[model samples]
Target: MKAAIATSYGSPDVIHLAEVPMPTPKPTEILVRIHASAVNAADWRLRSANPWFVRLVFGPFKPRRPILGVVFAGEVVGTGVAATKYKKGDKLFGWTSLMKLGGHAEYVALPETGAFAPIPAAMSYTDAAAIPFGFGTAFSFLRKAQVAQGQRVLIYGASGAVGSAAVQLAKTMGAQVTGVCSTRNTELVRSLGADHVLDYTKDDILAKRDLYDVVFETVGKLPFKESLALVKQSGTIITGSEMPTQMLARLFAGKADKQVKVIGGTALSTAADMKHLAQLSAEQAILPVIDQVLPLERIVEAHARAESGRKVGNVVVEMG
Candidate 1:
Protein backbone atom coordinates (compact mmCIF):
# COMPACT_ATOMS: atom_id res chain seq x y z
CA MET A 1 0.00 0.00 0.00
CA LYS A 2 1.15 3.49 -0.84
CA ALA A 3 0.68 6.08 1.89
CA ALA A 4 1.67 9.61 2.75
CA ILE A 5 3.47 9.05 6.02
CA ALA A 6 4.62 11.58 8.56
CA THR A 7 7.56 10.41 10.65
CA SER A 8 8.10 13.75 12.41
CA TYR A 9 5.67 16.63 12.48
CA GLY A 10 6.80 19.97 11.06
CA SER A 11 6.30 21.54 7.63
CA PRO A 12 4.36 19.96 4.73
CA ASP A 13 7.74 18.76 3.53
CA VAL A 14 7.74 16.27 6.42
CA ILE A 15 5.04 14.21 4.71
CA HIS A 16 6.64 11.61 2.42
CA LEU A 17 5.12 9.19 -0.06
CA ALA A 18 6.23 5.67 0.81
CA GLU A 19 5.36 2.05 0.24
CA VAL A 20 3.89 0.87 3.54
CA PRO A 21 2.50 -2.50 4.57
CA MET A 22 -1.11 -3.09 3.63
CA PRO A 23 -3.49 -2.90 6.56
CA THR A 24 -5.56 -5.94 7.45
CA PRO A 25 -8.92 -5.65 9.13
CA LYS A 26 -9.47 -6.89 12.63
CA PRO A 27 -12.26 -9.45 13.17
CA THR A 28 -14.71 -6.65 13.91
CA GLU A 29 -13.47 -4.38 11.13
CA ILE A 30 -13.81 -3.83 7.38
CA LEU A 31 -10.96 -3.13 5.00
CA VAL A 32 -11.61 -0.17 2.75
CA ARG A 33 -9.77 0.50 -0.51
CA ILE A 34 -9.65 4.28 -0.51
CA HIS A 35 -10.84 5.95 -3.71
CA ALA A 36 -10.34 9.50 -2.49
CA SER A 37 -9.65 11.62 0.60
CA ALA A 38 -9.83 15.28 1.54
CA VAL A 39 -7.35 17.63 3.17
CA ASN A 40 -8.70 19.76 6.01
CA ALA A 41 -7.62 21.99 8.91
CA ALA A 42 -7.36 18.95 11.17
CA ASP A 43 -4.87 17.33 8.79
CA TRP A 44 -2.50 20.28 8.80
CA ARG A 45 -3.05 21.00 12.47
CA LEU A 46 -2.04 17.45 13.36
CA ARG A 47 0.83 17.61 10.87
CA SER A 48 2.42 20.66 12.43
CA ALA A 49 0.94 20.49 15.93
CA ASN A 50 0.44 24.27 15.65
CA PRO A 51 -0.67 24.74 19.23
CA TRP A 52 1.85 23.21 21.64
CA PHE A 53 -0.96 21.24 23.30
CA VAL A 54 -1.34 19.01 20.21
CA ARG A 55 1.95 17.40 21.17
CA LEU A 56 0.15 15.64 24.01
CA VAL A 57 -1.85 13.52 21.52
CA PHE A 58 0.48 13.39 18.47
CA GLY A 59 3.58 12.87 20.68
CA PRO A 60 6.11 15.40 21.83
CA PHE A 61 9.03 13.93 19.85
CA LYS A 62 7.14 12.27 16.97
CA PRO A 63 3.61 11.47 15.84
CA ARG A 64 1.85 8.47 17.31
CA ARG A 65 -0.03 7.95 14.02
CA PRO A 66 2.07 8.06 10.84
CA ILE A 67 -0.73 8.37 8.25
CA LEU A 68 -2.56 11.72 8.29
CA GLY A 69 -6.11 12.15 7.05
CA VAL A 70 -9.52 12.43 8.62
CA VAL A 71 -12.10 12.28 5.81
CA PHE A 72 -12.23 9.43 3.27
CA ALA A 73 -14.54 8.06 0.57
CA GLY A 74 -13.74 4.45 -0.36
CA GLU A 75 -14.96 0.97 -1.26
CA VAL A 76 -15.01 -2.02 1.03
CA VAL A 77 -12.56 -4.54 -0.35
CA GLY A 78 -12.96 -7.10 2.40
CA THR A 79 -14.51 -7.65 5.80
CA GLY A 80 -13.39 -9.40 8.94
CA VAL A 81 -15.08 -12.52 10.30
CA ALA A 82 -17.32 -10.66 12.75
CA ALA A 83 -17.93 -7.54 10.68
CA THR A 84 -21.43 -7.90 9.23
CA LYS A 85 -22.45 -4.29 8.57
CA TYR A 86 -20.63 -4.05 5.19
CA LYS A 87 -19.26 -6.48 2.64
CA LYS A 88 -17.01 -6.41 -0.40
CA GLY A 89 -17.80 -3.76 -3.04
CA ASP A 90 -19.82 -1.52 -0.72
CA LYS A 91 -19.11 2.15 -1.35
CA LEU A 92 -18.71 4.28 1.77
CA PHE A 93 -17.43 7.52 3.27
CA GLY A 94 -16.56 8.62 6.79
CA TRP A 95 -14.07 10.27 9.11
CA THR A 96 -11.59 8.18 11.04
CA SER A 97 -11.91 8.49 14.81
CA LEU A 98 -9.46 10.71 16.71
CA MET A 99 -7.26 7.80 17.81
CA LYS A 100 -7.54 5.88 14.51
CA LEU A 101 -6.64 8.57 11.97
CA GLY A 102 -5.15 6.91 8.88
CA GLY A 103 -7.11 7.98 5.78
CA HIS A 104 -4.27 9.32 3.61
CA ALA A 105 -3.43 5.98 2.04
CA GLU A 106 -4.50 3.42 -0.55
CA TYR A 107 -6.32 1.42 2.13
CA VAL A 108 -7.46 1.62 5.75
CA ALA A 109 -9.31 -0.61 8.21
CA LEU A 110 -12.01 0.63 10.51
CA PRO A 111 -14.53 -1.07 12.76
CA GLU A 112 -17.83 -1.83 11.00
CA THR A 113 -19.68 0.20 13.62
CA GLY A 114 -17.42 3.23 13.23
CA ALA A 115 -18.32 6.51 11.52
CA PHE A 116 -18.33 5.05 7.97
CA ALA A 117 -21.46 5.36 5.82
CA PRO A 118 -22.54 4.18 2.35
CA ILE A 119 -22.00 6.87 -0.26
CA PRO A 120 -25.10 7.73 -2.27
CA ALA A 121 -25.00 6.32 -5.82
CA ALA A 122 -25.49 9.75 -7.34
CA MET A 123 -22.43 11.19 -5.62
CA SER A 124 -18.84 10.91 -6.80
CA TYR A 125 -16.09 9.55 -4.55
CA THR A 126 -14.40 12.93 -4.47
CA ASP A 127 -17.61 14.61 -3.36
CA ALA A 128 -18.25 12.01 -0.71
CA ALA A 129 -14.75 12.45 0.61
CA ALA A 130 -15.26 16.18 0.74
CA ILE A 131 -18.37 16.16 2.94
CA PRO A 132 -17.29 14.55 6.24
CA PHE A 133 -15.18 17.36 7.65
CA GLY A 134 -16.70 20.68 6.57
CA PHE A 135 -20.30 19.54 6.25
CA GLY A 136 -20.20 17.30 9.29
CA THR A 137 -18.71 20.05 11.46
CA ALA A 138 -21.23 22.62 10.31
CA PHE A 139 -24.13 20.21 10.79
CA SER A 140 -23.12 19.36 14.34
CA PHE A 141 -22.57 22.95 15.44
CA LEU A 142 -25.76 24.34 13.86
CA ARG A 143 -27.96 21.53 15.15
CA LYS A 144 -26.46 21.84 18.63
CA ALA A 145 -27.07 25.59 18.62
CA GLN A 146 -30.74 24.95 17.79
CA VAL A 147 -30.64 27.15 14.71
CA ALA A 148 -34.22 27.95 13.69
CA GLN A 149 -36.04 29.45 10.76
CA GLY A 150 -36.22 33.27 10.48
CA GLN A 151 -33.42 33.74 12.99
CA ARG A 152 -30.43 35.74 11.82
CA VAL A 153 -27.27 33.57 11.66
CA LEU A 154 -23.86 34.98 10.85
CA ILE A 155 -20.97 32.74 9.72
CA TYR A 156 -17.43 34.08 9.85
CA GLY A 157 -14.88 32.77 7.30
CA ALA A 158 -17.78 31.70 5.09
CA SER A 159 -15.86 30.58 1.97
CA GLY A 160 -13.71 27.75 3.35
CA ALA A 161 -14.88 24.18 3.83
CA VAL A 162 -16.64 24.40 7.20
CA GLY A 163 -17.76 27.99 6.56
CA SER A 164 -19.25 27.13 3.16
CA ALA A 165 -21.07 24.17 4.69
CA ALA A 166 -22.27 26.33 7.57
CA VAL A 167 -23.71 28.84 5.12
CA GLN A 168 -25.85 26.30 3.23
CA LEU A 169 -26.85 24.31 6.31
CA ALA A 170 -27.86 27.41 8.25
CA LYS A 171 -29.97 28.54 5.29
CA THR A 172 -31.60 25.11 4.99
CA MET A 173 -32.51 25.24 8.66
CA GLY A 174 -34.55 28.40 7.87
CA ALA A 175 -32.14 30.88 9.37
CA GLN A 176 -31.47 34.15 7.55
CA VAL A 177 -27.80 33.63 6.78
CA THR A 178 -25.04 36.25 6.76
CA GLY A 179 -21.60 35.16 5.50
CA VAL A 180 -18.28 36.91 6.14
CA CYS A 181 -15.34 36.25 3.84
CA SER A 182 -12.75 37.99 1.70
CA THR A 183 -13.78 40.38 -1.08
CA ARG A 184 -12.99 37.75 -3.73
CA ASN A 185 -15.47 35.25 -2.23
CA THR A 186 -18.51 37.49 -1.79
CA GLU A 187 -20.31 35.97 -4.76
CA LEU A 188 -19.34 32.45 -3.77
CA VAL A 189 -20.69 32.98 -0.26
CA ARG A 190 -23.85 34.55 -1.64
CA SER A 191 -24.38 31.57 -3.93
CA LEU A 192 -24.36 29.33 -0.86
CA GLY A 193 -27.60 31.06 0.21
CA ALA A 194 -26.28 33.81 2.46
CA ASP A 195 -28.91 36.56 2.59
CA HIS A 196 -26.13 39.06 3.26
CA VAL A 197 -22.39 38.90 2.51
CA LEU A 198 -19.72 40.89 4.34
CA ASP A 199 -16.24 41.16 2.94
CA TYR A 200 -13.90 41.18 5.97
CA THR A 201 -11.47 43.43 4.14
CA LYS A 202 -14.01 46.22 3.73
CA ASP A 203 -16.73 45.48 6.25
CA ASP A 204 -16.24 45.67 9.98
CA ILE A 205 -19.00 43.20 10.87
CA LEU A 206 -17.94 43.27 14.53
CA ALA A 207 -19.23 46.83 14.71
CA LYS A 208 -22.79 45.51 14.47
CA ARG A 209 -24.18 44.84 17.94
CA ASP A 210 -26.78 42.22 18.80
CA LEU A 211 -27.39 41.39 15.13
CA TYR A 212 -27.53 37.59 15.05
CA ASP A 213 -29.46 34.98 16.94
CA VAL A 214 -26.65 32.60 16.25
CA VAL A 215 -23.15 33.79 15.45
CA PHE A 216 -20.83 31.04 14.16
CA GLU A 217 -17.08 31.40 13.71
CA THR A 218 -16.43 28.54 11.32
CA VAL A 219 -12.67 29.03 10.93
CA GLY A 220 -12.04 29.49 14.67
CA LYS A 221 -10.33 32.85 14.08
CA LEU A 222 -12.70 35.33 15.71
CA PRO A 223 -12.09 36.72 19.19
CA PHE A 224 -14.31 35.08 21.80
CA LYS A 225 -15.50 38.35 23.31
CA GLU A 226 -16.35 39.74 19.89
CA SER A 227 -18.24 36.59 18.93
CA LEU A 228 -20.27 36.88 22.11
CA ALA A 229 -21.11 40.49 21.34
CA LEU A 230 -22.27 39.57 17.82
CA VAL A 231 -24.99 37.30 19.21
CA LYS A 232 -28.33 38.67 20.42
CA GLN A 233 -29.17 38.71 24.11
CA SER A 234 -29.33 35.14 25.38
CA GLY A 235 -28.36 33.92 21.92
CA THR A 236 -25.49 31.59 20.95
CA ILE A 237 -21.99 32.01 19.56
CA ILE A 238 -20.41 28.83 18.18
CA THR A 239 -16.73 28.69 17.31
CA GLY A 240 -14.57 25.88 15.97
CA SER A 241 -11.33 27.45 17.22
CA GLU A 242 -10.95 28.55 20.83
CA MET A 243 -8.53 29.63 23.51
CA PRO A 244 -8.03 27.96 26.90
CA THR A 245 -10.01 30.58 28.77
CA GLN A 246 -12.97 30.14 26.41
CA MET A 247 -12.80 26.34 26.62
CA LEU A 248 -12.57 26.41 30.41
CA ALA A 249 -15.52 28.77 30.62
CA ARG A 250 -17.64 26.53 28.41
CA LEU A 251 -16.59 23.46 30.38
CA PHE A 252 -17.67 24.94 33.72
CA ALA A 253 -20.77 26.59 32.27
CA GLY A 254 -22.36 23.11 32.15
CA LYS A 255 -24.79 21.86 29.49
CA ALA A 256 -26.85 25.08 29.18
CA ASP A 257 -26.20 28.78 29.56
CA LYS A 258 -28.96 31.17 30.50
CA GLN A 259 -27.02 34.23 29.50
CA VAL A 260 -25.37 34.74 26.13
CA LYS A 261 -23.52 31.43 25.59
CA VAL A 262 -20.18 31.17 23.85
CA ILE A 263 -19.41 27.70 22.58
CA GLY A 264 -15.89 26.80 21.55
CA GLY A 265 -16.94 23.35 20.49
CA THR A 266 -16.29 20.36 18.27
CA ALA A 267 -18.46 18.78 15.59
CA LEU A 268 -19.39 15.19 16.22
CA SER A 269 -18.32 12.91 13.34
CA THR A 270 -20.82 10.23 14.22
CA ALA A 271 -22.42 7.78 11.79
CA ALA A 272 -25.69 9.68 12.16
CA ASP A 273 -24.11 12.94 11.00
CA MET A 274 -22.56 11.18 8.01
CA LYS A 275 -25.97 9.72 7.11
CA HIS A 276 -27.56 13.16 7.36
CA LEU A 277 -24.90 14.64 5.08
CA ALA A 278 -25.39 11.75 2.62
CA GLN A 279 -29.10 12.40 2.40
CA LEU A 280 -28.52 16.12 1.93
CA SER A 281 -25.96 15.43 -0.80
CA ALA A 282 -28.31 12.95 -2.49
CA GLU A 283 -31.02 15.59 -2.61
CA GLN A 284 -28.57 18.34 -3.62
CA ALA A 285 -29.85 20.28 -0.64
CA ILE A 286 -26.31 20.95 0.56
CA LEU A 287 -23.34 20.61 -1.81
CA PRO A 288 -19.73 20.05 -0.74
CA VAL A 289 -17.86 22.87 -2.42
CA ILE A 290 -14.71 21.40 -4.01
CA ASP A 291 -11.82 23.79 -4.57
CA GLN A 292 -9.44 21.38 -6.33
CA VAL A 293 -8.56 17.71 -6.75
CA LEU A 294 -4.93 16.64 -6.52
CA PRO A 295 -3.33 13.22 -6.60
CA LEU A 296 -1.76 11.76 -3.44
CA GLU A 297 1.65 12.61 -4.88
CA ARG A 298 0.75 16.28 -4.80
CA ILE A 299 -0.22 16.08 -1.14
CA VAL A 300 2.49 18.58 -0.28
CA GLU A 301 0.88 21.15 -2.53
CA ALA A 302 -2.51 20.21 -1.13
CA HIS A 303 -1.26 20.73 2.42
CA ALA A 304 0.22 24.05 1.41
CA ARG A 305 -3.11 25.19 -0.01
CA ALA A 306 -5.09 24.12 3.02
CA GLU A 307 -2.54 25.77 5.32
CA SER A 308 -2.55 28.94 3.24
CA GLY A 309 -6.12 29.66 4.39
CA ARG A 310 -7.08 30.81 0.92
CA LYS A 311 -8.99 27.91 -0.65
CA VAL A 312 -12.67 28.44 -1.39
CA GLY A 313 -13.71 24.90 -0.35
CA ASN A 314 -12.61 21.30 0.11
CA VAL A 315 -9.35 20.19 -1.52
CA VAL A 316 -9.63 16.51 -2.46
CA VAL A 317 -6.86 13.92 -2.96
CA GLU A 318 -7.72 11.11 -5.34
CA MET A 319 -6.03 7.77 -4.86
CA GLY A 320 -4.09 6.50 -7.89
Candidate 2:
Protein backbone atom coordinates (compact mmCIF):
# COMPACT_ATOMS: atom_id res chain seq x y z
CA MET A 1 0.00 0.00 0.00
CA LYS A 2 1.17 3.53 -0.78
CA ALA A 3 0.62 6.25 1.81
CA ALA A 4 1.64 9.78 2.69
CA ILE A 5 3.68 9.54 5.86
CA ALA A 6 4.35 12.38 8.29
CA THR A 7 7.14 11.37 10.64
CA SER A 8 7.24 14.62 12.65
CA TYR A 9 5.23 17.80 12.96
CA GLY A 10 6.50 20.69 10.91
CA SER A 11 6.05 22.17 7.43
CA PRO A 12 4.22 20.43 4.59
CA ASP A 13 7.65 19.24 3.38
CA VAL A 14 7.66 16.74 6.26
CA ILE A 15 5.02 14.62 4.48
CA HIS A 16 6.31 12.16 1.87
CA LEU A 17 5.00 9.32 -0.27
CA ALA A 18 6.09 5.86 0.83
CA GLU A 19 5.19 2.23 0.48
CA VAL A 20 3.57 0.84 3.63
CA PRO A 21 2.14 -2.48 4.68
CA MET A 22 -1.45 -3.14 3.69
CA PRO A 23 -4.04 -3.15 6.43
CA THR A 24 -6.01 -6.30 7.20
CA PRO A 25 -9.47 -6.24 8.72
CA LYS A 26 -10.18 -7.78 12.06
CA PRO A 27 -13.14 -10.09 12.60
CA THR A 28 -15.40 -7.10 13.23
CA GLU A 29 -13.86 -4.86 10.60
CA ILE A 30 -13.91 -4.24 6.87
CA LEU A 31 -11.01 -3.52 4.50
CA VAL A 32 -11.53 -0.71 2.04
CA ARG A 33 -9.54 0.08 -1.09
CA ILE A 34 -9.39 3.88 -1.00
CA HIS A 35 -10.04 5.68 -4.26
CA ALA A 36 -9.95 9.26 -2.96
CA SER A 37 -9.38 11.36 0.19
CA ALA A 38 -9.43 15.01 1.17
CA VAL A 39 -6.98 17.48 2.66
CA ASN A 40 -8.64 19.55 5.39
CA ALA A 41 -7.74 21.82 8.31
CA ALA A 42 -7.37 18.75 10.53
CA ASP A 43 -4.60 17.29 8.35
CA TRP A 44 -2.48 20.47 8.31
CA ARG A 45 -3.22 21.32 11.95
CA LEU A 46 -2.05 17.91 13.14
CA ARG A 47 0.88 17.88 10.74
CA SER A 48 2.13 21.25 11.98
CA ALA A 49 1.19 20.55 15.64
CA ASN A 50 -0.43 23.97 15.66
CA PRO A 51 -2.10 25.46 18.77
CA TRP A 52 0.64 23.53 20.73
CA PHE A 53 -2.01 21.34 22.45
CA VAL A 54 -1.86 18.97 19.45
CA ARG A 55 1.62 18.02 20.71
CA LEU A 56 0.31 16.80 24.08
CA VAL A 57 -2.61 14.85 22.62
CA PHE A 58 -0.94 13.44 19.49
CA GLY A 59 2.69 13.23 20.62
CA PRO A 60 5.20 15.42 22.42
CA PHE A 61 7.80 15.50 19.65
CA LYS A 62 6.21 13.57 16.77
CA PRO A 63 2.80 12.48 15.52
CA ARG A 64 1.31 9.25 16.83
CA ARG A 65 -0.18 8.49 13.43
CA PRO A 66 1.92 8.83 10.27
CA ILE A 67 -0.86 8.74 7.67
CA LEU A 68 -3.06 11.77 8.41
CA GLY A 69 -6.50 11.83 6.84
CA VAL A 70 -9.91 11.74 8.52
CA VAL A 71 -12.27 11.12 5.58
CA PHE A 72 -12.18 8.71 2.64
CA ALA A 73 -14.28 7.55 -0.30
CA GLY A 74 -13.56 3.98 -1.38
CA GLU A 75 -14.79 0.49 -2.13
CA VAL A 76 -14.90 -2.43 0.26
CA VAL A 77 -12.41 -5.02 -0.95
CA GLY A 78 -12.78 -7.50 1.89
CA THR A 79 -14.71 -8.00 5.10
CA GLY A 80 -14.06 -10.01 8.19
CA VAL A 81 -16.31 -12.98 8.94
CA ALA A 82 -18.14 -11.09 11.68
CA ALA A 83 -18.53 -7.86 9.70
CA THR A 84 -21.98 -8.35 8.19
CA LYS A 85 -22.83 -4.69 7.55
CA TYR A 86 -20.88 -4.49 4.30
CA LYS A 87 -19.39 -6.93 1.79
CA LYS A 88 -16.91 -6.95 -1.07
CA GLY A 89 -17.59 -4.44 -3.88
CA ASP A 90 -19.70 -2.15 -1.70
CA LYS A 91 -18.89 1.53 -2.23
CA LEU A 92 -18.82 3.51 1.00
CA PHE A 93 -17.60 6.89 2.23
CA GLY A 94 -17.20 8.42 5.67
CA TRP A 95 -14.90 9.41 8.49
CA THR A 96 -12.12 7.12 9.88
CA SER A 97 -12.39 8.56 13.41
CA LEU A 98 -9.65 10.88 14.62
CA MET A 99 -8.04 8.09 16.65
CA LYS A 100 -7.64 5.80 13.61
CA LEU A 101 -6.88 8.37 10.94
CA GLY A 102 -5.46 6.57 7.85
CA GLY A 103 -7.43 7.78 4.87
CA HIS A 104 -4.45 9.15 2.91
CA ALA A 105 -3.49 5.70 1.67
CA GLU A 106 -4.40 3.05 -0.82
CA TYR A 107 -6.34 1.02 1.75
CA VAL A 108 -7.76 1.23 5.27
CA ALA A 109 -9.37 -1.14 7.79
CA LEU A 110 -12.08 0.01 10.15
CA PRO A 111 -14.82 -1.46 12.28
CA GLU A 112 -18.06 -2.19 10.41
CA THR A 113 -19.97 0.06 12.83
CA GLY A 114 -17.82 3.08 12.10
CA ALA A 115 -19.35 6.22 10.57
CA PHE A 116 -20.03 5.28 6.97
CA ALA A 117 -22.79 5.22 4.36
CA PRO A 118 -23.31 4.14 0.80
CA ILE A 119 -22.26 6.66 -1.84
CA PRO A 120 -24.81 7.35 -4.53
CA ALA A 121 -24.05 5.84 -7.94
CA ALA A 122 -24.04 9.22 -9.60
CA MET A 123 -21.53 10.80 -7.21
CA SER A 124 -17.80 10.63 -7.93
CA TYR A 125 -15.20 9.58 -5.40
CA THR A 126 -13.67 13.06 -5.40
CA ASP A 127 -17.03 14.54 -4.39
CA ALA A 128 -17.71 11.94 -1.73
CA ALA A 129 -14.25 12.50 -0.28
CA ALA A 130 -15.09 16.17 0.32
CA ILE A 131 -18.26 15.70 2.38
CA PRO A 132 -17.47 14.13 5.79
CA PHE A 133 -15.44 16.92 7.31
CA GLY A 134 -17.18 20.04 6.08
CA PHE A 135 -20.76 18.85 5.78
CA GLY A 136 -20.60 16.64 8.84
CA THR A 137 -19.25 19.40 11.03
CA ALA A 138 -21.79 21.91 9.78
CA PHE A 139 -24.66 19.45 10.19
CA SER A 140 -23.73 18.60 13.77
CA PHE A 141 -23.35 22.19 14.93
CA LEU A 142 -26.46 23.50 13.19
CA ARG A 143 -28.57 20.73 14.67
CA LYS A 144 -27.01 21.38 18.06
CA ALA A 145 -28.10 25.03 17.83
CA GLN A 146 -31.48 23.87 16.53
CA VAL A 147 -31.56 26.28 13.65
CA ALA A 148 -35.22 26.58 12.65
CA GLN A 149 -37.16 28.15 9.82
CA GLY A 150 -37.69 31.94 9.93
CA GLN A 151 -34.73 32.41 12.27
CA ARG A 152 -31.95 34.78 11.22
CA VAL A 153 -28.52 33.11 10.91
CA LEU A 154 -25.13 34.54 10.09
CA ILE A 155 -22.09 32.48 9.08
CA TYR A 156 -18.58 33.87 9.24
CA GLY A 157 -15.88 32.66 6.83
CA ALA A 158 -18.63 31.53 4.51
CA SER A 159 -16.37 30.37 1.67
CA GLY A 160 -14.38 27.66 3.43
CA ALA A 161 -15.50 24.05 3.67
CA VAL A 162 -17.40 24.20 6.94
CA GLY A 163 -18.64 27.71 6.29
CA SER A 164 -19.92 26.79 2.83
CA ALA A 165 -21.75 23.81 4.28
CA ALA A 166 -23.17 25.88 7.09
CA VAL A 167 -24.63 28.41 4.67
CA GLN A 168 -26.44 25.77 2.63
CA LEU A 169 -27.64 23.74 5.61
CA ALA A 170 -29.00 26.79 7.34
CA LYS A 171 -31.01 27.59 4.24
CA THR A 172 -32.30 24.03 4.06
CA MET A 173 -33.58 24.48 7.60
CA GLY A 174 -35.42 27.58 6.33
CA ALA A 175 -33.30 30.11 8.21
CA GLN A 176 -32.63 33.48 6.66
CA VAL A 177 -28.91 33.09 5.99
CA THR A 178 -26.25 35.79 5.94
CA GLY A 179 -22.76 34.79 4.78
CA VAL A 180 -19.55 36.73 5.42
CA CYS A 181 -16.57 36.20 3.12
CA SER A 182 -13.93 37.92 1.08
CA THR A 183 -14.93 40.12 -1.85
CA ARG A 184 -14.06 37.37 -4.32
CA ASN A 185 -16.47 34.83 -2.77
CA THR A 186 -19.60 36.99 -2.46
CA GLU A 187 -21.20 35.38 -5.48
CA LEU A 188 -20.21 31.90 -4.39
CA VAL A 189 -21.81 32.28 -0.98
CA ARG A 190 -24.89 33.88 -2.52
CA SER A 191 -25.25 30.90 -4.83
CA LEU A 192 -25.29 28.62 -1.77
CA GLY A 193 -28.64 30.17 -0.81
CA ALA A 194 -27.41 32.81 1.60
CA ASP A 195 -30.12 35.46 1.77
CA HIS A 196 -27.45 38.12 2.17
CA VAL A 197 -23.65 38.05 1.58
CA LEU A 198 -21.29 40.42 3.34
CA ASP A 199 -17.90 41.19 1.83
CA TYR A 200 -15.64 41.22 4.88
CA THR A 201 -13.24 43.53 3.14
CA LYS A 202 -15.81 46.25 2.64
CA ASP A 203 -19.00 45.43 4.51
CA ASP A 204 -19.44 46.83 7.97
CA ILE A 205 -21.18 43.90 9.66
CA LEU A 206 -21.06 45.56 13.05
CA ALA A 207 -22.77 48.67 11.74
CA LYS A 208 -25.97 46.78 11.01
CA ARG A 209 -28.65 47.52 13.58
CA ASP A 210 -30.38 44.18 13.19
CA LEU A 211 -29.17 41.29 15.33
CA TYR A 212 -29.39 37.64 14.37
CA ASP A 213 -30.98 34.72 16.17
CA VAL A 214 -27.85 32.66 15.50
CA VAL A 215 -24.31 33.79 14.72
CA PHE A 216 -21.96 31.02 13.63
CA GLU A 217 -18.22 31.59 13.64
CA THR A 218 -16.97 28.78 11.41
CA VAL A 219 -13.31 29.77 10.98
CA GLY A 220 -12.36 30.74 14.58
CA LYS A 221 -11.09 33.98 13.13
CA LEU A 222 -14.11 36.04 14.18
CA PRO A 223 -13.76 37.73 17.55
CA PHE A 224 -15.96 36.34 20.31
CA LYS A 225 -16.98 39.81 21.42
CA GLU A 226 -18.04 40.67 17.90
CA SER A 227 -20.18 37.55 17.65
CA LEU A 228 -21.63 38.36 21.05
CA ALA A 229 -22.71 41.76 19.78
CA LEU A 230 -24.22 40.34 16.60
CA VAL A 231 -26.58 37.84 18.18
CA LYS A 232 -30.01 38.89 19.47
CA GLN A 233 -30.94 38.46 23.10
CA SER A 234 -31.19 34.82 24.20
CA GLY A 235 -29.77 33.65 20.87
CA THR A 236 -27.10 31.01 20.21
CA ILE A 237 -23.57 31.33 18.87
CA ILE A 238 -21.83 28.30 17.39
CA THR A 239 -18.02 28.45 17.40
CA GLY A 240 -16.68 25.76 15.08
CA SER A 241 -13.05 26.66 15.80
CA GLU A 242 -12.02 27.83 19.28
CA MET A 243 -8.66 27.74 21.00
CA PRO A 244 -8.17 26.96 24.70
CA THR A 245 -8.26 30.64 25.66
CA GLN A 246 -11.28 31.25 23.47
CA MET A 247 -13.04 28.34 25.14
CA LEU A 248 -12.45 29.83 28.57
CA ALA A 249 -13.71 33.17 27.30
CA ARG A 250 -16.79 31.48 25.91
CA LEU A 251 -17.54 29.96 29.30
CA PHE A 252 -17.21 33.27 31.12
CA ALA A 253 -19.11 35.12 28.44
CA GLY A 254 -21.98 32.68 28.53
CA LYS A 255 -22.18 32.88 32.31
CA ALA A 256 -21.97 36.65 32.33
CA ASP A 257 -24.88 37.11 29.95
CA LYS A 258 -27.03 34.24 31.27
CA GLN A 259 -29.21 34.63 28.21
CA VAL A 260 -26.79 34.24 25.29
CA LYS A 261 -25.57 30.69 24.76
CA VAL A 262 -22.08 30.00 23.45
CA ILE A 263 -21.44 26.55 22.04
CA GLY A 264 -17.96 25.27 21.24
CA GLY A 265 -16.48 21.78 21.06
CA THR A 266 -15.68 18.93 18.74
CA ALA A 267 -18.28 18.16 16.06
CA LEU A 268 -19.40 14.52 16.14
CA SER A 269 -20.87 12.53 13.26
CA THR A 270 -22.81 9.29 13.33
CA ALA A 271 -23.80 6.70 10.73
CA ALA A 272 -27.20 8.38 10.52
CA ASP A 273 -25.59 11.75 9.84
CA MET A 274 -23.57 10.27 7.01
CA LYS A 275 -26.68 8.72 5.55
CA HIS A 276 -28.49 12.04 5.63
CA LEU A 277 -25.58 13.82 3.97
CA ALA A 278 -25.47 11.15 1.28
CA GLN A 279 -29.15 11.61 0.59
CA LEU A 280 -28.75 15.38 0.46
CA SER A 281 -25.85 15.01 -1.97
CA ALA A 282 -27.85 12.67 -4.21
CA GLU A 283 -30.66 15.21 -4.30
CA GLN A 284 -28.22 18.07 -4.99
CA ALA A 285 -29.50 19.83 -1.91
CA ILE A 286 -26.08 20.28 -0.28
CA LEU A 287 -23.16 20.19 -2.74
CA PRO A 288 -19.56 19.84 -1.57
CA VAL A 289 -17.62 22.67 -3.13
CA ILE A 290 -14.25 21.45 -4.43
CA ASP A 291 -11.30 23.76 -5.07
CA GLN A 292 -8.89 21.32 -6.72
CA VAL A 293 -7.88 17.68 -7.05
CA LEU A 294 -4.39 16.18 -6.82
CA PRO A 295 -2.88 12.71 -6.95
CA LEU A 296 -1.68 10.84 -3.85
CA GLU A 297 1.92 11.19 -4.97
CA ARG A 298 1.58 14.94 -4.58
CA ILE A 299 0.35 14.77 -1.01
CA VAL A 300 2.86 17.44 -0.03
CA GLU A 301 1.38 19.79 -2.59
CA ALA A 302 -2.09 18.89 -1.39
CA HIS A 303 -1.15 19.85 2.15
CA ALA A 304 0.33 23.10 0.94
CA ARG A 305 -2.77 23.93 -1.04
CA ALA A 306 -5.06 23.26 1.90
CA GLU A 307 -2.97 25.49 4.18
CA SER A 308 -2.62 28.25 1.60
CA GLY A 309 -5.96 29.83 2.71
CA ARG A 310 -6.75 30.49 -0.94
CA LYS A 311 -8.80 27.40 -1.59
CA VAL A 312 -12.50 28.14 -1.87
CA GLY A 313 -13.70 24.72 -0.74
CA ASN A 314 -11.99 21.31 -0.45
CA VAL A 315 -8.67 19.97 -1.75
CA VAL A 316 -9.14 16.33 -2.78
CA VAL A 317 -6.34 13.78 -3.35
CA GLU A 318 -6.99 10.86 -5.64
CA MET A 319 -5.36 7.54 -4.74
CA GLY A 320 -4.26 6.63 -8.23
lDDT for every model?
A: 0.88, 0.92
Error of 2 at 16 (Å): 0.3
lDDT by residue (207-255, candidate 1, tens digit) is: 8767899999887677666776677888988877675666665556433
Q: Which ten residues in a row have the lowest lDDT in candidate 2?
A: 249-258
The residue-level lDDT of candidate 1 at 7 comes to 93
Candidate 2 per-residue lDDT, tens place, 1-320, comes to: 89999999999999999999999899999999999999999999999998898999899999999999999999999999899999899999999988789999999999999998999889999999999999999999999999998999999999998999999999889999999999999999999999999998998999742389999999988878888888888898899999888887766664356377777789989989999999998999999899999999999999999998778889999998
* Residue 139 in model 2: lDDT: 94
Instruction: Find the 10 residues in a row with the least total lDDT in model 1.
Output: 249-258
Q: Cα miss at 78, model 1 (Å)?
A: 0.4
TM-score of each: 0.95, 0.97
Q: What's the lDDT of the predicted structure labeled candidate 1?
A: 0.88
RMSD of each: 2.5, 1.3
Candidate 2: residue 294 Cα off by (Å) = 0.6
Clashing pairs in 2: none
